[model samples]
Target chain A: MSWEKVFFALLIFPGLLYAVPTAWLMLWLERKFRARMQGRIGPPFYQPFFDFVKLMAKRRVLRPSFDSIFMMGLPLVSVSAGLLALALLPISSDSRGFAGDLVLLVAFLEVPSLCSVLAGFASRSIFGQVGATREAILSITYNLPFLTAIVALAYSAQSLRLVDIAASPAGGVRALAVLTICLCLPVKLRINPFSVSNAEQEIYSGPATEFSGPQLAMWELAHGLEWVALTGLVVCLGLTFRTGTWIGDFAIYTSLSLVLVILLTILATGTARLKIQQAARFYWRWGMGLSLVALILGVFPDIERFIR
Target chain B: MNIFSVLLKNLRMGPATLRFPEEVPYPKGFHGPVKIHTEKCICCGMCAYVCVSGAVRVAEHKDNCEWVYSPGLCTFCGKCVSVCPVEALHMAAKSAPSYFNTKALDEVHLVPYSPCPECGRPTPPVREVLRAKAFKGVAPNVLVKSLICQRCRQKDSQRALVSIQVKGEPPPSRSDK
Candidate 1:
């Protein structure tokens, strides 16, 4: 097969199929993981699918004053953007992998979150308004450190192509850039310390309170896909140990992804939600500082050579 | 010491939350409502007076005895039954009284009292329940009286006998009066 066909078959098609179950599975797994951490028995594996079916059977009741059109539009766009971003990630050496430039992938990954803020804002309730503001602030703060780290890597590699960057010189400045991306995963996924927007206690599920029935299901599906996609992206950035074979690469990548998912799920369960301002402060002070240091390390090859 | 204690404490679990609507059992000591044994009440106002929650309201009209019980205010203390001179009150384990309005809590009942057919004496409800309990094993069937107060017993007896002697049958006594 030609490289273009290989890319479409390997990355885009599998990525699309992978997005559905991965999102659905992550949601069920998250509930189960969270329950285990909190010393409770959570729902079963098919719980998320059951929840979607149950929601589909439910009647939708919109508040008279709510902006129904915008509320309906938000979740659909969010999940589509997440799945599209997943399609852009290069999980294997394939034809369609080059379709998504790293910059474009980053922009697509952010669309769902941006739409979340819009969803919250359109509801016009006090809680919804506050939640939208929080989501907007968090998005800006987390994405800054994230994009800075990505740009630093892109600068060093001389290519915004994700596969090309992945195939770059291993165990060098590129390696640190890859690690920085790994650090960025949890923030993009909006796990603890960064989970100010959807904190259940402080905001009553915040941006998602007014979301119910099918719209709510879409948001949940997006969240699940986003989880697996972020983890897959981390693995794609050359964080694997393979013997130059497809089977070896697949085994290594899948194992590493599973490990990363487990670690993050544990972290999510262990931590409590922080205030919005506290989260912003954390991202600005520590998150930005660490990512900047990584970026600086990735840029200064002479320093790396001198140290070696 | 601290580390071991912390580990042990974390290992210890919180109160188990009951599975609602399925594995849930009724709570202990669930005294739902007050039941009246009409013959046992003496109209002494003791139940009304002694009740700290004021759950029971008793009013003795000229011809009728009235009893009002508020299930909401009643903590199910069972104090009213204990203080009842005539043993009129019994704790209803099942059948709780419930309503949307607070005013609906006031449910009044008119207790039935049996006076003696011959003597016309009032029979206390407590004594009757106790008698029923005591004699159930001994007597296969027992007819108990629950009408007329203790004072009217002799008058009713004399009037009955006199009517039978004069009319060669029983006569109605003081129909208007």
Candidate 2:
């Protein structure tokens, strides 16, 4: 890709401009939906943006032992990883299709959580330490099923390229694979019930406790961008419907994401936060179980074809 | 009960939060600030006495009777309103608005005292004294006697006791003590 194309993809098209705002909007939607469910008036549409601005305006404070450079840089690294993942995803059937992009996307998806772990360790706070440990354990618990679900999708499409996956018609096994992904997304996103890593009530924002000012703002931004990337991935891999025009395709993609977001919000509001042990057990049992079934279903192409 | 069902029910019912500031309707009987009707207030000091937070101050002097309320210190318990003898105080359903400066929150209402009929000295507000008399079930004659200043009233009481002693009647036992 040319430098201009790289810049456009990374900073404009599917990167900072597109991903950041969309993620902020999605976070706002989650808050509003949850508040409504609890019979309360939630914050306005601009609340997320306001919070970001407020965080940016705050004074930066660093601990004596912490490396300021590493602490500040990790959030950017996470955001870049998410943007790269989005760029790798072919938005339409005619878009570029790279080999083994699915594997690359999965690896990129893990970077944000890994960054959180590193950040937590770097902070040297007790809450940060505990939060990092929880995140590490959660990453382990959810990554297997998440990756397995993706592999199941790949097996169904017979290609690791995202474009092929989007182009193919979704069937029973693929639908189950999508369901497995849907279940795991909440855990990955740290939404309610599966929000053991952050566990705000217990740990006071967990891994993000010590980060302040621009660093904290970037972390929040990275989280939002990650939301876009991961949800966009789900939409691309599971709910993509091509139209001849880019606008139509983009609209469908956004609409599907809205549906997924609504579903996730409802689930979040309905359930209480789970303990770390409970979360692990839940993933090991239900998460792993569903993905295993999807995997079994995907392995038998004849069966999937017959079902279709 | 499934959470999904609860969520669905809540969605159907809509939000429970009021659109405050734009539509400032509070629930019925909601305890807010203590509202004083200065005209009805007899300065009986019941509200001041009952106030737990020391937000109410009823100062009755020779020259003036003042009822001061500090909204900043008010607990909004409605105890003062409940204890008011003449129903001068009631809990308004609107809270005190926040102020940038602290001094704005303190409110003072001063009612000048009425002169004593005989001694021509400053006394408690006439309306307040009358209300207190009525609330305490004092007879008209006793109410008249209570209008005198402390020194004159004491002298009058002493003269009455001497007259009673001369009449060979035992003075009424000091029940107030």
Candidate 3:
């Protein structure tokens, strides 16, 4: 690809422009769906946009002890990582994918959480410190099962390239790996049951307590972009069907993303927030157990063949 | 609770959101903004006195009285509406739309006043004073007598007492008869 085309792909298509809006839509969908389930009229469709703008327009306030550079830079890093991860995903047959991009994708996915830890530490607030500590603990607890699930999927495809794994035919092992992904997703995204790091009631927005104005706006935007990237990962891994045309394939991918968002929203609404220790224990026990089973199943081709 | 059943039921019932701004039909008896009928206002300052938040201000100037309603400070308690003797104040079904500017929520109603007949001192708006007198069931002559300033009314009462003592309680006046 030409430099210009690459830049366009990274900055516009399947990048910031695309991911940000989709992420905002996911936020709206989450709120609206929860409201409907509870028999209440939710916010308007443009509410997310309004919130983003309002946050951006607010005056920036920083404590004297805060490291402004680190506090502000982390969210930008998160956004870049999310966009880079999305760019690596094969939305169409012509999309770029290098060997071992699955590992890169996983690294990119974890960078945002790492950034959150750094941001919390830099904020110099007690709540931020506590939030950072919780996030750091969560990262360690959730990363193992999340990586194991990906490894299991890679083992099933017998390739480390995302496109190859996605294009490969469905199998029993891949299905099990997909199930493991589903179980781990809530923890990774910090959905209701696993949202200990930023529990608003307990920690007051946790890492985000001290962030204000445009810096906070950027953090929220990064969060939205992260949602798109993660949901896209699930779509690529689980569905992965193509119609031989880029447009048709993208349409299928978009629909799969929508379905995943709806499913995630339902899961989020149905559960209560788990304490940090509870979340850690749950991930270590059930999440690890499921991914391990899927991993063992992926290792044995004969069993998958028999099951199919 | 089974989440799937809830989800299915909601889906069947359709979306719960109202298309607001276009179709926001306020519920019946909704305690929204307080409405003031300027013509019926008695300028008794009762609404302002009862307003716990001080959202309603009755300013009496030399020549005029100003009634200011600050919707921003209002808690929608409906106390002012209930306390209004002339039934001028009411809770409207429509609420004041949220404004980006604070000044937009302030409403000022200016009413001109009349001077007391005896002392020529400025009083509250003539229409409101008359309305209040009529609401209190005062006869026309007594209503006219009430329009004088407090000092002037005391002087007149003292003069009447002096005349009664001097004339040894003469026969009732024509109007009384």
Candidate 4:
């Protein structure tokens, strides 16, 4: 691969330049959708962007050495992981992905959660530690199905590279895997019903309780990028459409992500937050059931045909 | 109702909230700006007396009294409205009108003084409401007596004292001692 092409992939289309603005817009759109669902006039279109600027303009407060270090470093680390994952996803079918790129994408996706857990512990606060512990537990809980779904998709395609996965036509097994991934998105994004890790009421914003000023802004940016990465992954998987040009595919990707945003917002607005135990139970039962079925069908292709 | 149905209804109903720049409907008995009924005022200065913020000023002139109220300075405490002996001052039920300049928001009501009946001096005119209140149980002559200026009333009292004759035995006086 040429360095110029790699540079274009990392910093231009589907990179930081395109992803940042789209991330902010998606965040705004989700909030707007939630507001409309609740019969209220939501924020203006520029709210998320304005919020980032406002937060960045605030004065940074100094803290103890231990809490200080993580506060400075963790958001950078977390956001980098999210950005890298976004760049790796095959939003367009022409992405030059290699073997085991799916596994690498999954690893990059997990880094933010790991950083959040570490950030919580480093805060040296009761609420933060509780949040960190919940985050760790939820990570494990959600990953069971989350990883299994990706594995199932990889198995169905018979290749671990995202480009090959995109090349593979979706089947009944792939359909089940998509459903399994959909079930995990709410938890992955910290939306209600699965937001136990950062329960604002119970745990005071969870791991992010102590963050303020520009650090908090970074956290918010990371979250927005996470939206793009995770939803983009789903969109890339479920609707593998090619419209001749990358721009057309990019447009389709954006439109599908917004549609996904609306769906998630509805789910978030409808349900109250579940307790950590209840969330764990939910995943272990329904989520695990779907993932196991998909994995089983992938291992033995005869089962799906028998069911049909 | 189920959340999905509620969401659908909300989607259909639009927002129940008032939009930005739209004025909220005033509630009943909301305390608004101070307004004066010029004719009913007796120039007693009670509103001015009770005004903590000095929003109300009663300027007494020989020919007239100017009742000036600055809504910009008003704290909307409703004290002036409550203490007006002659129910002339009242709080408006609606919001105060917008003003380009706070200096122009001063409301001046003229309380003209009529010439006194007994003495030709200009005296603050009392309202009929005050008249009926003060002379509630008295006869018609009291109305005539009350309308005279204060100086004339004092002179009449002195003259009445001079005309009265002594009726009792005199006590031992210092001069006799």
Candidate 5:
């Protein structure tokens, strides 16, 4: 790929410039939607933006000399990784991503989470350490379904390129692949039911308990970008319409991502937080079963023909 | 109904909470900070006596009675208002504003003491409301006796007895001589 094209992909549409504002908007919408459901007036529309700015202006927390640099680097790394992951998405139809780019996307998607697990331990706070450990355990449980779903989609397309898999026709296997992946998003995003690690009532802010000021702001930005990058994946695979124009496809993608956000908000608002053991059981039993079925069908696409 | 139905109903019904923090209205029968009506207060110290939290304090000076009430110390139990003799203490409709200094939040009222006309001694002022309940338009002489100090009033009664004992004679009391 040309350096100019690579820079445009990483810095322009579907990248940092587009994702930052959209991610913050999505976060605010989630909070507002939940508040309304609970019969509250919620916050003003500018609340998220104001909060981000205020946090950025606050003084940084004093940390031990040995840990200050290590603590500050994690959020920066996560945010960079989150932005990199978003750039890999083929929101535009003329995506020139290379072969096995799906593996790159998945690898980039895991970076923020791995950094979070490290952050919790590096903070030297009891809450942070406990939150980090829970995050570590939950990640292991959720990745089973996440990886299998991607593998099934790749197998069905007979190619490892995300663009090819996204272009595949809709069918039972593709639908199941989407379902399995959807089940993992809540856990990955740390929303209700699977939000045991970061439960405010239980472990404070999970791995981010000790981070403050600019560090905390970066962590928040990374989380918002995660919302965009992950949900954008769902939007890519789920949407099939095309008007043979860039702007038209972009509009469709944006609207679908919004709809998915609303659906996720409803799911979060209606469900209560789950205990760690309960969350693990739900994933290990139900999630493991669905992922196995998708894997079986993926490894043997001819089995669908035989069963029919 | 499920959460969706409830959510829709709530959305249609509008928010159950106030839009602004200051917009929340005090509930009915909610007792707030104590407010004293300086005009009606007799400074009988009944409020201070009944206050369980020691929120109400009465300080008696030679010329005036100082009534101090701190909302911070007040339990908002309304006992002090109920025990007030002249209906002087009543609670405000809303709680006091944020507290920075405790002394600044105290509601202070200085009720002037009425001096006895005969001996220039300070006496607890009986307001019209208390006077109406204590005496029902008694004779002028009786009213005059109540208006003076006890020492001066007792001397007048003693002089009347001596004069009654000796007809056309001056009283034997040293002051009369």
Candidate 6:
């Protein structure tokens, strides 16, 4: 068998099963961590699974004149898009698609966000309307800073391919790229401040409000896979790896996943939610602007060289 | 002001719901319903008399042979216990009392009177002093006692009919005790 075929098959298996427990696990962990930080005991690890089952058993009732097919298709798209993103990302240097262009990776990342907006629009709920608006605004906000960081890295490396970027010299503005990526972490995870799409206080889970039964479960599963995919992208793009064996791949991916989960939980517990406008303003005014200046400074490495 | 304070506020106020299936300690100053012991009650109306809250009421039903305490009106005050001639009305220390509505709040009962076997009348005491006894901390108009006039008590001993005791203290227990 060809190496690419083996890698592709390997990726498919993990991505497909990723949603099964990942959804329940992330939800339970988030609740548990938040509870402990607040001096209480939260629900058990199985709580999310039980909740999914309960919601599934409820009678499937749609609103009058609602598009059932559109609503149903959106969640399926979310799950598949997230899984596809996971499969496309390079797990290690040896993995297939590591040679893929940075722009292709960006395109893959956009799919899940697109799915989120589509789900909101498809539901035809007022909350979904609000969610879709906020989500679109969020896309406009973070996608800039996020894309800028990737572009800065790509520019410095002199290649659009992710594997080539990893192969580049580490002496340039690599550290700056890493910092910006870390700051963008919350947005990519759909956490606080930028989490207006799922604002429970304002719109009662927004796009997810009307979605019950298996559809809700699928959406939640897609969310978890997105978390995993984002973390994998971060690890693949920047971190140096020593992967000679399958065990090494497993250990690295697992540790990275845990770190991302912990980072998100802490951020969620510690931060207050931001208004839609505040989120837009922060990303546009300060976050994206700071990174842009960093990118510009990084590219023209020295007027200082001439001055000195 | 800073991220730390904001986080602290969110953490403290956020939904960190408690685990159920295990008993939780009652919050401070939680007042549960008052308890009354029928055997120890001296029927002294002191609980009703001293009760400034008007939570206690006592009345007489003539046909029954016992005094009925409407614990619904009884406050958790030890005052009723303190004033009882025979220490009959004692408040139990169990404090958890959960209910669906406000009506559940004032409806506990203790009956000292029993219905007559022959006429179903709540038998009344022979002496005026004994008949005047009321559960402590109960309301004035809701106690179970004699409803027929003194003349009716004297004239009709055999054919006397029992009426529902609707006066004095209201029962504190909403459900059957």
Predicted structure with the largest DockQ when compared to the true one: 2
Candidate 5 chain B lDDT trough over 10 residues, lowest sum: B168-177
Task: Report the C-alpha lDDT of model 1 over B105-164, residue by residue, as the tens digit.
Answer: 578877644455546444433365555654444422122222344555456567678878
Q: What is the DockQ of each candidate?
A: 0.10, 0.66, 0.27, 0.65, 0.65, 0.22
Show pairs that collide, candidate 3. Answer: none
Answer with 3 or 5, whichever has the higher lDDT: 5
Residue-by-residue lDDT tens digits, candidate 6, A110-221: 8777877877887888998888878888888888888788888887777777767766666446666766677777776778856788888888887777788878877777
In angstroms, give how far residue A130 of model 1 lies from its true place.
Answer: 1.2
Error of 4 at B153 (Å): 3.6
Considering DockQ, where higher is better, how would the candidates rank from best to worst?
A: 2, 5, 4, 3, 6, 1
Better of 1 and 5 by TM-score: 5
Clashes of 4: 0
How well does candidate 1 match the true structure in TM-score terms?
A: 0.72
Per residue, candidate 1 scores C-alpha lDDT tens digits across A227-269 of: 8778877787756433566566666666677778877777676
TM-score of chain B of each: 0.49, 0.70, 0.73, 0.82, 0.74, 0.43
What is the per-residue lDDT of model 5 for residues B77-111, given as tens digits with 9 covering 90 to 100?
Answer: 99988877678877888878886887778778898
What range of 10 consecutive residues in model 2 chain A has the weakest lDDT sum?
A89-98
CAPRI quality band, candidate 2: medium
What is each model's TM-score for chain A?
A: 0.89, 0.94, 0.94, 0.97, 0.97, 0.87
Query: What does fnat come to for each candidate?
Result: 0.00, 0.81, 0.39, 0.81, 0.74, 0.32
Model 5 misplaced stretches (Cα beyond 4 Å): B49-55, B61-63, B115-122, B128-144, B150-177
Instruction: Name the runs in model 1 displaced over 4 angstroms.
Output: A1-13, A62-66, A172-175, A242-255, B1-82, B85-122, B126-148, B151-177
How many collisions per candidate? 19, 1, 0, 0, 0, 59
Superposed by TM-score, candidate 2 places the C-alpha of residue A255 at a distance from the truth, in angstroms, of 1.5
Candidate 5 lDDT, A225-286, residue by residue in tens: 99999999988876664556899988988888888888898888888999889988888887
TM-score of chain B of 6: 0.43
